[model samples]
Target: MARKPGALRNGAPFRDWVLPAAMEKVRKRLKTVDDGDRQMVTILGCVPGDGITAVEAACQEALD
Candidate 1:
């Protein structure tokens, strides 16, 4: 079946802000939950992964 425009099919594009958007929440959370002075680091060798939607959903859940 043909996928929708934003469908997470093979080769579908994920946004540039996916990681940054997620990390922004993490930064705020860390400030409240952990040491406010500590910095968080994430390493992504690839730009877009197969599970981008799941990650986005998780970030949204964290913000809520």
Candidate 2:
């Protein structure tokens, strides 16, 4: 299968404290998710009109 351009290996950007923090956020969101609802997660890279760091942080927080 082909990989997404913005995708990083093993979520390297979110390291150390950031990783744990992100995981907690994702877990909390997951708890409230509706049953049978497909979760769509995307990690945005350094692109125009997007912050690579911020997007990574958000995705890490929501899906990483």
Candidate 3:
């Protein structure tokens, strides 16, 4: 996949702590979900070699 414009490899602009905090937030949110919903919901964390980090829902559609 092509890289997004103006993106840093090491997760710039945001503080270094932001990625972990975001993952934790997603985990916390999923914890409160029902068992069926929880099965569908997933938190994905990506740490690129360039130092870029990302966290996002992997199964939003399933949860919905």
Candidate 4:
């Protein structure tokens, strides 16, 4: 059978490609740690639009 555009036979392409790429970039931007540095990591996500911006700002503040 023929498949539709952006339609995967199984699972989600965005989850495999887009999310991983974005996360890799985020990880690369993270600061290095020393023995005294904490190793805590937090992730915040929200739906597109103003909600996402708000969540991102909150994450930045928390991370900072």
Candidate 5:
């Protein structure tokens, strides 16, 4: 996902990975930006270390 952010949209590996509501919302919003894919991938990459809950909270904070 970090290397090929575009795959996050239709990649088989991420087919079953459901994002948190806020994260998903942020992701959809990011899709509109020119480098959104890369930006989202960077955010997603933080999940392994920061955890989904933390990332989700951050996404929510960002949205707010």
Candidate 6:
């Protein structure tokens, strides 16, 4: 995703992957900005170390 961020929008692998609700909301919002795909991918990359739950919570908090 870092190398090919557009894949997150059209890639087969991502199409089947279900994101947490908050993350999904963030993704939708990100889609509206320039280089949003790359930004989203950067956020997604944090999951490995931060964990999805933490990321999701942070996304929700940010939304709030």
Which has the better lDDT: candidate 3, or candidate 4?
Answer: 4
> How high is the lDDT of residue 49 in model 5?
100
Q: Could you tell which candidate, 2 or 5, scores higher by TM-score? A: 5
Ranking by lDDT: 6, 5, 1, 2, 4, 3
Score every model by TM-score.
Answer: 0.32, 0.27, 0.32, 0.29, 0.85, 0.93
Candidate 1: which stretches are off by over 4 Å? 1-18, 35-50
lDDT of 1 by residue, 1-64 (tens): 1223222112235423445577457545654544332233221212256365665565568678
- lDDT for each of the candidates? 0.43, 0.40, 0.36, 0.37, 0.89, 0.93
Off by over 4 Å in 5: none
Can you list the residue pairs that collide in candidate 4?
none
Better of 1 and 6 by lDDT: 6
Candidate 6 lDDT at 54 equals 96
Residue-wise C-alpha lDDT for candidate 6, range 1-64, written one tens digit per residue: 6898999999998897899999999999999999999989988999999999999999999899
Error of 5 at 45 (Å): 0.5
- Regions of candidate 3 where Cα sits further than 4 Å from its true position: 1-19, 35-41, 45-52, 56-64
Clashes of each: 0, 0, 3, 0, 0, 0
The worst-scoring run of ten residues by lDDT in candidate 2 lies at 36-45
Error of 6 at 16 (Å): 2.6
Q: Supply candidate 4's per-residue lDDT for 14.
A: 34
Best-performing candidate as measured by TM-score: 6
Q: State model 4's lDDT.
A: 0.37
Better of 2 and 4 by TM-score: 4
Please tell me which model should have the higher TM-score, number 1 or number 3: 1
Number of colliding residue pairs in model 1: 0
Higher-scoring candidate on lDDT, 2 or 5: 5
Residues 1-64 of candidate 5: C-alpha lDDT, one tens digit per residue: 6677889878898778888999999988998998898998999889999999999999999999
Candidate achieving the largest lDDT? 6
Per-residue error for 62 in candidate 3, Å, reads 15
Ten-residue region with minimum lDDT total, candidate 5: 1-10
